[model samples]
Target: MEIVVSISDMKVTSRAKDVIVTHALGSCLGLAAYDPVAGVAGLIHCLLPLARDSKAPQKNPAMYVNTGVPQMMRAMFGRGATRENLILKAAGCGRMMHISNQFDTGANNFAALQKLLQVNEMHLSAEDVGGTIPRTMRLFADTGRLVISSCGRSWEL
Candidate 1:
Protein backbone atom coordinates (compact mmCIF):
# COMPACT_ATOMS: atom_id res chain seq x y z
CA MET A 1 0.00 0.00 0.00
CA GLU A 2 1.15 3.50 -0.83
CA ILE A 3 0.23 6.31 1.54
CA VAL A 4 0.46 9.81 0.14
CA VAL A 5 1.34 12.70 2.43
CA SER A 6 -0.01 15.91 1.01
CA ILE A 7 1.32 19.37 1.74
CA SER A 8 0.87 20.38 5.37
CA ASP A 9 0.14 16.79 6.27
CA MET A 10 1.81 13.78 7.89
CA LYS A 11 1.42 10.08 8.40
CA VAL A 12 2.96 7.32 10.50
CA THR A 13 2.69 3.58 10.22
CA SER A 14 4.20 0.36 11.48
CA ARG A 15 2.74 -1.87 8.83
CA ALA A 16 5.42 -3.41 6.68
CA LYS A 17 3.27 -3.26 3.59
CA ASP A 18 2.86 0.49 3.62
CA VAL A 19 5.05 2.91 1.70
CA ILE A 20 4.69 6.57 2.60
CA VAL A 21 5.28 9.12 -0.18
CA THR A 22 5.13 12.87 -0.76
CA HIS A 23 5.60 14.94 -3.91
CA ALA A 24 5.91 18.49 -5.32
CA LEU A 25 8.68 19.51 -2.94
CA GLY A 26 9.64 22.84 -4.43
CA SER A 27 10.28 25.46 -1.75
CA CYS A 28 8.96 22.94 0.73
CA LEU A 29 10.46 20.24 2.92
CA GLY A 30 9.90 16.52 3.34
CA LEU A 31 10.82 14.95 6.67
CA ALA A 32 11.16 11.22 7.26
CA ALA A 33 11.67 9.46 10.57
CA TYR A 34 11.91 5.76 11.10
CA ASP A 35 12.74 3.22 13.78
CA PRO A 36 14.23 0.11 12.26
CA VAL A 37 13.93 -2.03 15.36
CA ALA A 38 10.27 -1.26 15.88
CA GLY A 39 9.36 -1.09 12.18
CA VAL A 40 7.70 2.27 12.67
CA ALA A 41 7.99 5.08 10.14
CA GLY A 42 6.64 8.56 9.53
CA LEU A 43 6.73 11.28 6.88
CA ILE A 44 5.86 14.98 6.99
CA HIS A 45 5.31 17.40 4.12
CA CYS A 46 5.86 20.90 5.48
CA LEU A 47 5.03 23.89 3.28
CA LEU A 48 6.56 26.72 5.30
CA PRO A 49 9.27 27.58 7.78
CA LEU A 50 7.14 29.01 10.56
CA ALA A 51 3.59 29.22 11.79
CA ARG A 52 3.67 32.48 13.74
CA ASP A 53 1.53 34.38 11.25
CA SER A 54 -1.58 32.26 11.41
CA LYS A 55 -3.55 29.64 13.31
CA ALA A 56 -2.40 26.92 10.92
CA PRO A 57 -0.20 25.37 13.53
CA GLN A 58 -3.05 25.03 15.97
CA LYS A 59 -5.14 23.36 13.32
CA ASN A 60 -2.64 21.56 11.08
CA PRO A 61 0.73 21.42 12.75
CA ALA A 62 2.26 19.82 9.67
CA MET A 63 2.06 23.07 7.75
CA TYR A 64 5.32 24.44 9.19
CA VAL A 65 8.71 22.95 9.82
CA ASN A 66 8.83 24.26 13.38
CA THR A 67 5.81 22.24 14.41
CA GLY A 68 5.60 19.58 11.72
CA VAL A 69 8.91 17.89 12.34
CA PRO A 70 8.35 17.32 16.03
CA GLN A 71 4.73 16.40 15.51
CA MET A 72 5.74 13.73 13.00
CA MET A 73 8.35 12.41 15.41
CA ARG A 74 5.82 12.05 18.18
CA ALA A 75 3.52 10.09 15.89
CA MET A 76 6.32 7.65 15.19
CA PHE A 77 7.24 7.43 18.85
CA GLY A 78 3.71 6.48 19.67
CA ARG A 79 4.07 3.40 17.54
CA GLY A 80 6.55 1.62 19.78
CA ALA A 81 9.38 3.75 18.46
CA THR A 82 11.94 5.23 20.80
CA ARG A 83 13.07 8.83 20.40
CA GLU A 84 16.74 7.90 20.30
CA ASN A 85 16.18 5.12 17.83
CA LEU A 86 14.50 7.35 15.29
CA ILE A 87 16.52 7.90 12.13
CA LEU A 88 15.84 11.37 10.79
CA LYS A 89 16.22 12.29 7.15
CA ALA A 90 14.94 15.11 4.98
CA ALA A 91 14.67 16.18 1.33
CA GLY A 92 13.35 18.99 -0.88
CA CYS A 93 13.71 22.66 0.10
CA GLY A 94 14.65 23.51 -3.44
CA ARG A 95 15.45 26.97 -4.72
CA MET A 96 12.57 27.46 -7.10
CA MET A 97 13.03 31.14 -7.88
CA HIS A 98 15.99 32.75 -9.62
CA ILE A 99 15.90 35.95 -7.61
CA SER A 100 18.67 35.95 -5.03
CA ASN A 101 17.20 38.69 -2.87
CA GLN A 102 13.95 36.85 -2.37
CA PHE A 103 12.93 35.44 0.98
CA ASP A 104 14.22 32.00 -0.01
CA THR A 105 11.58 29.90 1.70
CA GLY A 106 13.46 26.72 0.91
CA ALA A 107 16.57 27.76 2.81
CA ASN A 108 14.53 29.02 5.72
CA ASN A 109 12.54 25.82 5.76
CA PHE A 110 15.70 23.73 5.93
CA ALA A 111 17.18 25.85 8.69
CA ALA A 112 14.02 25.77 10.75
CA LEU A 113 13.81 21.99 10.46
CA GLN A 114 17.44 21.71 11.50
CA LYS A 115 16.82 23.78 14.60
CA LEU A 116 13.80 21.69 15.49
CA LEU A 117 15.78 18.48 15.21
CA GLN A 118 18.59 19.94 17.28
CA VAL A 119 16.18 21.12 19.95
CA ASN A 120 14.62 17.68 20.09
CA GLU A 121 18.05 16.08 20.50
CA MET A 122 17.56 14.16 17.28
CA HIS A 123 20.34 13.25 14.91
CA LEU A 124 19.73 13.74 11.18
CA SER A 125 21.57 10.92 9.55
CA ALA A 126 21.24 11.93 5.90
CA GLU A 127 19.55 14.29 3.47
CA ASP A 128 19.32 15.42 -0.17
CA VAL A 129 18.39 19.06 -0.18
CA GLY A 130 19.05 22.55 -1.55
CA GLY A 131 19.00 22.61 -5.31
CA THR A 132 17.26 24.36 -8.14
CA ILE A 133 15.15 21.33 -8.88
CA PRO A 134 12.03 19.91 -7.30
CA ARG A 135 11.99 16.41 -5.94
CA THR A 136 9.80 13.68 -4.53
CA MET A 137 10.45 11.80 -1.30
CA ARG A 138 9.44 8.39 -0.05
CA LEU A 139 9.69 6.16 2.99
CA PHE A 140 9.40 2.38 2.84
CA ALA A 141 7.93 1.15 6.08
CA ASP A 142 9.02 -2.43 5.67
CA THR A 143 12.73 -1.69 5.24
CA GLY A 144 12.79 1.96 6.32
CA ARG A 145 14.25 2.86 2.93
CA LEU A 146 14.23 6.61 2.34
CA VAL A 147 14.67 7.82 -1.23
CA ILE A 148 14.66 11.19 -2.98
CA SER A 149 13.97 11.51 -6.69
CA SER A 150 14.77 14.30 -9.10
CA CYS A 151 15.94 14.95 -12.65
CA GLY A 152 15.14 11.46 -13.79
CA ARG A 153 17.29 9.97 -11.07
CA SER A 154 16.73 8.69 -7.55
CA TRP A 155 18.96 7.93 -4.60
CA GLU A 156 18.63 6.87 -1.02
CA LEU A 157 18.94 9.65 1.51
Candidate 2:
Protein backbone atom coordinates (compact mmCIF):
# COMPACT_ATOMS: atom_id res chain seq x y z
CA MET A 1 0.00 0.00 0.00
CA GLU A 2 1.03 3.57 -0.74
CA ILE A 3 0.29 6.19 1.88
CA VAL A 4 0.39 9.84 0.90
CA VAL A 5 1.45 12.33 3.53
CA SER A 6 0.07 15.69 2.50
CA ILE A 7 1.43 19.07 3.48
CA SER A 8 1.40 19.61 7.22
CA ASP A 9 0.67 15.98 7.83
CA MET A 10 2.44 12.72 8.70
CA LYS A 11 1.99 8.97 8.47
CA VAL A 12 3.61 6.03 10.27
CA THR A 13 3.30 2.36 9.51
CA SER A 14 4.82 -0.98 10.35
CA ARG A 15 3.32 -2.84 7.41
CA ALA A 16 6.01 -4.31 5.21
CA LYS A 17 4.11 -3.56 2.01
CA ASP A 18 3.66 0.14 2.76
CA VAL A 19 5.40 2.96 0.97
CA ILE A 20 5.01 6.42 2.52
CA VAL A 21 5.38 9.49 0.32
CA THR A 22 5.00 13.24 0.33
CA HIS A 23 4.96 15.67 -2.64
CA ALA A 24 5.33 19.38 -3.50
CA LEU A 25 8.07 20.12 -0.98
CA GLY A 26 8.98 23.64 -2.07
CA SER A 27 9.72 25.74 1.01
CA CYS A 28 8.42 22.85 3.04
CA LEU A 29 10.21 20.05 4.86
CA GLY A 30 9.83 16.34 4.17
CA LEU A 31 11.23 14.17 6.94
CA ALA A 32 11.42 10.38 6.98
CA ALA A 33 12.46 7.98 9.70
CA TYR A 34 12.67 4.23 9.73
CA ASP A 35 13.84 1.44 11.98
CA PRO A 36 14.98 -1.46 9.88
CA VAL A 37 14.88 -4.00 12.66
CA ALA A 38 11.41 -2.98 13.75
CA GLY A 39 10.01 -2.80 10.25
CA VAL A 40 8.55 0.61 11.01
CA ALA A 41 8.68 3.80 8.96
CA GLY A 42 7.27 7.30 9.18
CA LEU A 43 7.12 10.44 7.04
CA ILE A 44 6.22 14.01 7.93
CA HIS A 45 5.71 17.10 5.78
CA CYS A 46 6.04 20.29 7.78
CA LEU A 47 5.00 23.69 6.39
CA LEU A 48 6.52 26.15 8.87
CA PRO A 49 9.35 26.30 11.42
CA LEU A 50 7.33 27.07 14.49
CA ALA A 51 3.82 26.93 15.78
CA ARG A 52 4.26 29.96 18.02
CA ASP A 53 4.46 32.17 14.97
CA SER A 54 1.06 31.19 13.76
CA LYS A 55 -1.59 33.90 13.88
CA ALA A 56 -3.86 31.62 15.87
CA PRO A 57 -3.47 28.49 17.93
CA GLN A 58 -2.56 25.74 15.52
CA LYS A 59 -4.77 22.69 15.79
CA ASN A 60 -2.51 20.46 13.76
CA PRO A 61 0.89 20.06 15.37
CA ALA A 62 2.14 18.61 12.11
CA MET A 63 1.89 22.04 10.48
CA TYR A 64 5.12 23.24 12.13
CA VAL A 65 8.53 21.62 12.28
CA ASN A 66 8.96 22.16 16.00
CA THR A 67 5.82 20.31 16.86
CA GLY A 68 5.50 18.01 13.90
CA VAL A 69 8.87 16.33 14.18
CA PRO A 70 8.32 15.34 17.79
CA GLN A 71 4.83 14.16 17.09
CA MET A 72 6.07 11.98 14.24
CA MET A 73 8.87 10.58 16.38
CA ARG A 74 6.44 9.63 19.13
CA ALA A 75 4.18 7.89 16.68
CA MET A 76 7.07 5.95 15.23
CA PHE A 77 8.31 4.94 18.65
CA GLY A 78 4.83 3.81 19.60
CA ARG A 79 4.89 1.53 16.57
CA GLY A 80 8.07 -0.19 17.90
CA ALA A 81 10.73 2.04 16.37
CA THR A 82 13.67 2.79 18.62
CA ARG A 83 15.66 6.01 18.70
CA GLU A 84 18.97 4.24 18.44
CA ASN A 85 17.86 2.20 15.46
CA LEU A 86 16.01 4.96 13.66
CA ILE A 87 17.49 6.09 10.37
CA LEU A 88 16.44 9.64 9.69
CA LYS A 89 16.41 11.35 6.28
CA ALA A 90 15.09 14.62 4.98
CA ALA A 91 14.22 16.40 1.70
CA GLY A 92 12.79 19.71 0.45
CA CYS A 93 13.40 23.11 2.09
CA GLY A 94 13.77 24.87 -1.22
CA ARG A 95 14.10 28.58 -1.77
CA MET A 96 11.02 29.29 -3.81
CA MET A 97 10.25 32.41 -5.85
CA HIS A 98 8.23 35.28 -4.36
CA ILE A 99 9.65 34.31 -0.98
CA SER A 100 12.28 36.80 0.09
CA ASN A 101 15.64 35.83 1.56
CA GLN A 102 14.88 37.90 4.65
CA PHE A 103 12.09 35.49 5.43
CA ASP A 104 13.71 32.34 4.13
CA THR A 105 11.13 29.89 5.28
CA GLY A 106 13.00 26.93 3.87
CA ALA A 107 16.24 27.78 5.63
CA ASN A 108 14.45 28.53 8.86
CA ASN A 109 12.49 25.33 8.65
CA PHE A 110 15.63 23.25 8.24
CA ALA A 111 17.40 25.09 11.04
CA ALA A 112 14.51 24.58 13.40
CA LEU A 113 14.40 20.91 12.59
CA GLN A 114 18.12 20.60 13.19
CA LYS A 115 17.82 22.30 16.55
CA LEU A 116 14.99 20.07 17.60
CA LEU A 117 16.82 16.93 16.58
CA GLN A 118 19.96 18.04 18.35
CA VAL A 119 18.04 18.79 21.51
CA ASN A 120 16.62 15.29 21.41
CA GLU A 121 20.05 13.75 20.66
CA MET A 122 18.90 12.67 17.22
CA HIS A 123 20.46 13.23 13.82
CA LEU A 124 19.57 12.77 10.17
CA SER A 125 21.33 9.91 8.45
CA ALA A 126 20.96 11.56 5.03
CA GLU A 127 19.29 14.49 3.33
CA ASP A 128 18.64 16.24 0.02
CA VAL A 129 17.72 19.76 0.92
CA GLY A 130 18.20 23.39 -0.16
CA GLY A 131 17.66 24.43 -3.78
CA THR A 132 15.18 26.29 -5.95
CA ILE A 133 13.26 23.23 -7.07
CA PRO A 134 10.45 21.38 -5.36
CA ARG A 135 10.81 17.73 -4.45
CA THR A 136 9.03 14.51 -3.62
CA MET A 137 10.13 12.12 -0.87
CA ARG A 138 9.35 8.46 -0.41
CA LEU A 139 10.15 5.87 2.22
CA PHE A 140 9.84 2.11 1.88
CA ALA A 141 8.75 0.46 5.10
CA ASP A 142 10.18 -2.93 4.32
CA THR A 143 13.69 -1.77 3.50
CA GLY A 144 13.95 1.68 5.03
CA ARG A 145 14.92 3.12 1.67
CA LEU A 146 14.39 6.82 1.16
CA VAL A 147 14.15 8.16 -2.37
CA ILE A 148 14.06 11.83 -3.21
CA SER A 149 12.91 13.18 -6.58
CA SER A 150 13.13 16.63 -8.09
CA CYS A 151 13.22 18.10 -11.58
CA GLY A 152 12.84 14.70 -13.23
CA ARG A 153 15.72 13.29 -11.24
CA SER A 154 15.36 10.76 -8.49
CA TRP A 155 17.99 9.44 -6.09
CA GLU A 156 18.29 7.65 -2.79
CA LEU A 157 18.96 9.86 0.17
Candidate 3:
Protein backbone atom coordinates (compact mmCIF):
# COMPACT_ATOMS: atom_id res chain seq x y z
CA MET A 1 0.00 0.00 0.00
CA GLU A 2 1.18 3.51 -0.80
CA ILE A 3 0.43 6.20 1.76
CA VAL A 4 0.69 9.79 0.59
CA VAL A 5 1.82 12.41 3.08
CA SER A 6 0.60 15.78 1.95
CA ILE A 7 2.02 19.18 2.80
CA SER A 8 2.05 19.89 6.53
CA ASP A 9 1.19 16.25 7.20
CA MET A 10 2.75 13.06 8.48
CA LYS A 11 2.21 9.29 8.38
CA VAL A 12 3.66 6.37 10.30
CA THR A 13 3.20 2.67 9.71
CA SER A 14 4.58 -0.68 10.83
CA ARG A 15 2.97 -2.74 8.10
CA ALA A 16 5.54 -4.35 5.83
CA LYS A 17 3.41 -3.71 2.79
CA ASP A 18 3.24 0.03 3.42
CA VAL A 19 5.26 2.63 1.54
CA ILE A 20 5.04 6.19 2.80
CA VAL A 21 5.67 9.04 0.36
CA THR A 22 5.58 12.81 0.07
CA HIS A 23 5.74 14.78 -3.18
CA ALA A 24 6.52 18.19 -4.71
CA LEU A 25 9.03 19.30 -2.11
CA GLY A 26 10.06 22.78 -3.12
CA SER A 27 10.62 25.15 -0.22
CA CYS A 28 8.88 22.55 1.92
CA LEU A 29 10.69 19.63 3.51
CA GLY A 30 10.24 15.86 3.37
CA LEU A 31 11.59 13.93 6.35
CA ALA A 32 11.62 10.14 6.58
CA ALA A 33 12.56 7.84 9.46
CA TYR A 34 12.61 4.07 9.75
CA ASP A 35 13.51 1.42 12.27
CA PRO A 36 14.61 -1.74 10.56
CA VAL A 37 14.32 -4.05 13.55
CA ALA A 38 10.83 -2.82 14.34
CA GLY A 39 9.70 -2.68 10.73
CA VAL A 40 8.36 0.79 11.29
CA ALA A 41 8.50 3.84 9.02
CA GLY A 42 7.43 7.48 9.21
CA LEU A 43 7.33 10.52 6.89
CA ILE A 44 6.62 14.18 7.54
CA HIS A 45 6.27 17.18 5.26
CA CYS A 46 6.74 20.59 6.84
CA LEU A 47 5.99 23.95 5.28
CA LEU A 48 7.66 26.34 7.68
CA PRO A 49 10.62 26.46 10.05
CA LEU A 50 8.80 27.14 13.30
CA ALA A 51 5.27 27.28 14.62
CA ARG A 52 5.93 30.31 16.82
CA ASP A 53 6.76 32.43 13.79
CA SER A 54 3.37 31.92 12.23
CA LYS A 55 0.88 34.74 12.74
CA ALA A 56 -2.18 32.54 12.54
CA PRO A 57 -3.20 30.06 15.17
CA GLN A 58 -1.44 26.77 14.81
CA LYS A 59 -3.90 24.02 13.98
CA ASN A 60 -1.52 21.30 12.84
CA PRO A 61 1.82 20.69 14.54
CA ALA A 62 3.04 19.10 11.33
CA MET A 63 3.04 22.45 9.57
CA TYR A 64 6.38 23.51 11.02
CA VAL A 65 9.76 21.83 11.20
CA ASN A 66 10.14 22.47 14.91
CA THR A 67 6.93 20.70 15.87
CA GLY A 68 6.55 18.26 12.99
CA VAL A 69 9.91 16.50 13.27
CA PRO A 70 9.54 15.73 16.95
CA GLN A 71 5.96 14.65 16.43
CA MET A 72 7.02 12.15 13.80
CA MET A 73 9.80 10.81 16.02
CA ARG A 74 7.41 10.28 18.89
CA ALA A 75 4.89 8.62 16.63
CA MET A 76 7.53 6.26 15.28
CA PHE A 77 8.71 5.36 18.75
CA GLY A 78 5.13 4.73 19.78
CA ARG A 79 4.96 2.21 16.97
CA GLY A 80 7.95 0.25 18.36
CA ALA A 81 10.74 2.27 16.75
CA THR A 82 13.66 2.97 19.04
CA ARG A 83 16.03 5.92 19.12
CA GLU A 84 19.16 3.91 18.51
CA ASN A 85 17.59 1.90 15.71
CA LEU A 86 15.94 4.75 13.89
CA ILE A 87 17.40 5.93 10.61
CA LEU A 88 16.61 9.47 9.51
CA LYS A 89 16.70 10.93 6.01
CA ALA A 90 15.56 14.22 4.53
CA ALA A 91 14.85 15.82 1.14
CA GLY A 92 13.60 19.09 -0.30
CA CYS A 93 14.53 22.52 1.14
CA GLY A 94 15.10 23.99 -2.27
CA ARG A 95 15.35 27.62 -3.23
CA MET A 96 12.34 27.33 -5.49
CA MET A 97 10.92 30.80 -5.07
CA HIS A 98 12.52 34.09 -6.08
CA ILE A 99 12.62 35.38 -2.56
CA SER A 100 15.34 37.43 -0.86
CA ASN A 101 18.14 35.71 0.99
CA GLN A 102 16.73 36.82 4.34
CA PHE A 103 13.42 35.20 3.47
CA ASP A 104 14.97 31.91 2.41
CA THR A 105 12.39 29.57 3.84
CA GLY A 106 14.16 26.48 2.54
CA ALA A 107 17.44 27.20 4.32
CA ASN A 108 15.67 28.19 7.49
CA ASN A 109 13.61 25.01 7.40
CA PHE A 110 16.69 22.83 7.07
CA ALA A 111 18.50 24.70 9.83
CA ALA A 112 15.55 24.32 12.17
CA LEU A 113 15.35 20.61 11.46
CA GLN A 114 19.06 20.19 12.13
CA LYS A 115 18.82 22.01 15.43
CA LEU A 116 15.85 19.93 16.53
CA LEU A 117 17.62 16.70 15.70
CA GLN A 118 20.77 17.84 17.46
CA VAL A 119 18.84 18.79 20.58
CA ASN A 120 17.33 15.32 20.66
CA GLU A 121 20.73 13.68 20.07
CA MET A 122 19.57 12.44 16.68
CA HIS A 123 21.07 12.87 13.23
CA LEU A 124 20.04 12.30 9.66
CA SER A 125 21.66 9.27 8.08
CA ALA A 126 21.20 10.67 4.60
CA GLU A 127 19.84 13.86 3.09
CA ASP A 128 19.28 15.31 -0.38
CA VAL A 129 18.56 18.96 0.23
CA GLY A 130 19.38 22.54 -0.80
CA GLY A 131 18.92 22.86 -4.55
CA THR A 132 16.63 24.84 -6.83
CA ILE A 133 14.62 21.79 -7.81
CA PRO A 134 11.72 19.89 -6.30
CA ARG A 135 12.00 16.41 -4.89
CA THR A 136 9.89 13.42 -3.89
CA MET A 137 10.72 11.26 -0.90
CA ARG A 138 9.65 7.70 -0.16
CA LEU A 139 10.18 5.30 2.71
CA PHE A 140 9.71 1.55 2.41
CA ALA A 141 8.39 0.18 5.67
CA ASP A 142 9.51 -3.38 5.02
CA THR A 143 13.20 -2.71 4.47
CA GLY A 144 13.80 0.80 5.79
CA ARG A 145 14.79 1.96 2.34
CA LEU A 146 14.65 5.70 1.72
CA VAL A 147 14.65 7.05 -1.82
CA ILE A 148 14.75 10.57 -3.23
CA SER A 149 13.60 11.46 -6.73
CA SER A 150 14.17 14.67 -8.65
CA CYS A 151 14.26 15.67 -12.29
CA GLY A 152 13.42 12.18 -13.50
CA ARG A 153 16.28 10.74 -11.47
CA SER A 154 15.76 8.58 -8.41
CA TRP A 155 18.29 7.21 -5.97
CA GLU A 156 18.48 5.63 -2.54
CA LEU A 157 19.23 8.06 0.23
Candidate 4:
Protein backbone atom coordinates (compact mmCIF):
# COMPACT_ATOMS: atom_id res chain seq x y z
CA MET A 1 0.00 0.00 0.00
CA GLU A 2 1.25 3.45 -0.94
CA ILE A 3 0.14 6.57 0.90
CA VAL A 4 0.58 10.06 -0.51
CA VAL A 5 1.32 12.88 1.93
CA SER A 6 0.76 16.51 0.95
CA ILE A 7 2.37 19.72 2.12
CA SER A 8 2.22 20.57 5.83
CA ASP A 9 0.93 17.11 6.51
CA MET A 10 2.30 14.05 8.30
CA LYS A 11 1.67 10.31 8.60
CA VAL A 12 3.04 7.52 10.77
CA THR A 13 2.56 3.78 10.62
CA SER A 14 3.86 0.52 12.00
CA ARG A 15 2.58 -1.58 9.14
CA ALA A 16 5.34 -3.30 7.29
CA LYS A 17 3.64 -3.05 3.93
CA ASP A 18 3.39 0.72 3.83
CA VAL A 19 5.21 2.95 1.38
CA ILE A 20 4.84 6.70 1.64
CA VAL A 21 5.59 9.23 -1.04
CA THR A 22 5.77 13.04 -1.13
CA HIS A 23 6.20 14.39 -4.61
CA ALA A 24 7.30 17.62 -6.28
CA LEU A 25 8.95 19.05 -3.17
CA GLY A 26 10.42 22.20 -4.71
CA SER A 27 11.00 25.12 -2.35
CA CYS A 28 9.36 22.98 0.27
CA LEU A 29 10.71 20.62 2.98
CA GLY A 30 10.38 16.88 3.39
CA LEU A 31 11.16 15.24 6.73
CA ALA A 32 11.12 11.52 7.46
CA ALA A 33 11.78 9.68 10.70
CA TYR A 34 11.90 5.93 11.05
CA ASP A 35 12.59 3.30 13.68
CA PRO A 36 13.83 0.29 11.78
CA VAL A 37 13.54 -2.12 14.69
CA ALA A 38 9.90 -1.35 15.21
CA GLY A 39 8.89 -1.11 11.59
CA VAL A 40 7.50 2.34 12.33
CA ALA A 41 7.96 5.49 10.26
CA GLY A 42 6.65 9.03 9.93
CA LEU A 43 6.88 11.63 7.18
CA ILE A 44 6.10 15.36 7.02
CA HIS A 45 5.85 17.70 4.05
CA CYS A 46 6.22 21.30 5.15
CA LEU A 47 5.51 24.20 2.82
CA LEU A 48 6.41 27.52 4.43
CA PRO A 49 9.45 28.41 6.56
CA LEU A 50 8.10 29.91 9.74
CA ALA A 51 5.22 29.37 12.13
CA ARG A 52 5.83 32.59 14.08
CA ASP A 53 3.80 34.69 11.62
CA SER A 54 0.95 32.25 11.27
CA LYS A 55 -2.14 32.57 13.45
CA ALA A 56 -3.23 29.15 12.23
CA PRO A 57 -0.62 27.45 14.38
CA GLN A 58 -2.62 28.34 17.46
CA LYS A 59 -5.87 27.08 15.95
CA ASN A 60 -5.03 24.32 13.49
CA PRO A 61 -1.61 23.48 14.99
CA ALA A 62 -0.74 20.78 12.44
CA MET A 63 -0.28 23.43 9.77
CA TYR A 64 3.07 24.74 10.98
CA VAL A 65 6.58 23.39 11.53
CA ASN A 66 6.82 24.43 15.19
CA THR A 67 3.78 22.34 16.02
CA GLY A 68 3.97 19.75 13.29
CA VAL A 69 7.39 18.32 14.09
CA PRO A 70 6.45 17.39 17.63
CA GLN A 71 3.13 16.06 16.45
CA MET A 72 4.94 13.74 14.09
CA MET A 73 7.24 12.62 16.88
CA ARG A 74 4.33 11.77 19.11
CA ALA A 75 2.59 9.88 16.36
CA MET A 76 5.67 7.79 15.83
CA PHE A 77 5.89 7.14 19.54
CA GLY A 78 2.33 5.89 19.54
CA ARG A 79 3.46 3.27 17.08
CA GLY A 80 6.00 1.96 19.61
CA ALA A 81 8.94 4.11 18.63
CA THR A 82 11.65 5.59 20.82
CA ARG A 83 13.22 9.01 20.42
CA GLU A 84 16.76 7.70 20.61
CA ASN A 85 16.16 5.06 17.93
CA LEU A 86 14.62 7.26 15.26
CA ILE A 87 16.69 7.77 12.15
CA LEU A 88 16.00 11.20 10.69
CA LYS A 89 16.23 12.15 7.04
CA ALA A 90 15.13 15.07 4.84
CA ALA A 91 14.77 16.21 1.25
CA GLY A 92 13.73 19.25 -0.88
CA CYS A 93 14.46 22.93 -0.08
CA GLY A 94 15.30 23.70 -3.69
CA ARG A 95 15.54 27.22 -5.03
CA MET A 96 12.94 27.98 -7.68
CA MET A 97 14.17 31.43 -8.75
CA HIS A 98 17.12 32.36 -10.93
CA ILE A 99 20.29 33.93 -9.51
CA SER A 100 19.13 37.43 -10.42
CA ASN A 101 15.85 37.04 -8.53
CA GLN A 102 15.75 37.94 -4.83
CA PHE A 103 13.39 35.22 -3.73
CA ASP A 104 15.52 32.47 -2.21
CA THR A 105 12.91 30.02 -1.03
CA GLY A 106 15.39 27.15 -0.73
CA ALA A 107 17.74 28.91 1.66
CA ASN A 108 14.94 30.22 3.85
CA ASN A 109 13.24 26.84 3.99
CA PHE A 110 16.48 25.15 5.00
CA ALA A 111 17.14 27.69 7.72
CA ALA A 112 13.66 27.36 9.14
CA LEU A 113 13.94 23.59 9.26
CA GLN A 114 17.27 23.84 11.04
CA LYS A 115 15.79 26.13 13.65
CA LEU A 116 12.82 23.86 14.21
CA LEU A 117 15.00 20.81 14.58
CA GLN A 118 17.36 22.60 16.95
CA VAL A 119 14.48 23.64 19.15
CA ASN A 120 13.42 19.98 19.33
CA GLU A 121 17.03 18.78 19.86
CA MET A 122 17.03 16.60 16.76
CA HIS A 123 18.97 16.50 13.51
CA LEU A 124 18.95 14.68 10.22
CA SER A 125 21.30 11.77 9.59
CA ALA A 126 20.82 11.82 5.83
CA GLU A 127 19.51 14.35 3.32
CA ASP A 128 19.28 15.39 -0.31
CA VAL A 129 18.44 19.06 -0.29
CA GLY A 130 19.07 22.46 -1.91
CA GLY A 131 18.98 22.84 -5.70
CA THR A 132 16.73 24.29 -8.39
CA ILE A 133 14.83 21.05 -8.96
CA PRO A 134 11.93 19.04 -7.63
CA ARG A 135 12.16 15.71 -5.80
CA THR A 136 10.20 12.57 -5.03
CA MET A 137 10.70 10.94 -1.61
CA ARG A 138 9.80 7.32 -1.07
CA LEU A 139 9.75 5.64 2.33
CA PHE A 140 9.83 1.87 2.34
CA ALA A 141 8.44 0.49 5.55
CA ASP A 142 9.76 -3.01 5.02
CA THR A 143 13.32 -1.83 5.48
CA GLY A 144 12.78 1.59 7.01
CA ARG A 145 14.86 2.92 4.18
CA LEU A 146 14.01 6.22 2.50
CA VAL A 147 14.83 6.61 -1.16
CA ILE A 148 14.80 9.98 -2.86
CA SER A 149 14.75 10.06 -6.62
CA SER A 150 15.02 13.50 -8.20
CA CYS A 151 16.41 15.23 -11.30
CA GLY A 152 17.64 11.97 -12.77
CA ARG A 153 19.48 11.01 -9.60
CA SER A 154 18.62 8.61 -6.80
CA TRP A 155 19.82 8.61 -3.17
CA GLU A 156 19.43 6.42 -0.14
CA LEU A 157 18.22 8.35 2.90
Write down the TM-score of every candidate. 0.94, 0.94, 0.94, 0.88
Candidate 2 per-residue C-alpha lDDT over 29-92 given as tens digits, one digit per residue, 9 for 90 to 100: 9999999988999999999998886642258999999989999889988988899999999888
| Quality of model 3 by C-alpha lDDT | 0.90
lDDT of 1 by residue, 127-157 (tens): 8888888888889999889888888999888
Q: What TM-score does structure 3 among the candidates reach?
A: 0.94
lDDT (Cα atoms) of all candidates against the true structure = 0.88, 0.91, 0.90, 0.81
The CA lDDT at 125 in model 3 is: 90
Off by over 4 Å in 1: none
Top lDDT prediction, candidate number? 2
With a 3 Å backbone cut-off (N, CA, C), the pairs that clash in candidate 2 are none
Model 1, C-alpha of 18: deviation from truth (Å): 0.7
Q: How much does candidate 2 score in TM-score?
A: 0.94
Error of 3 at 33 (Å): 0.3
lDDT winner between candidates 1 and 2: 2
What lDDT would candidate 4 get against the real structure? 0.81
| lDDT of model 1, residue 105 | 91
Stretches of candidate 3 exceeding 4 Å from the true structure? 53-58
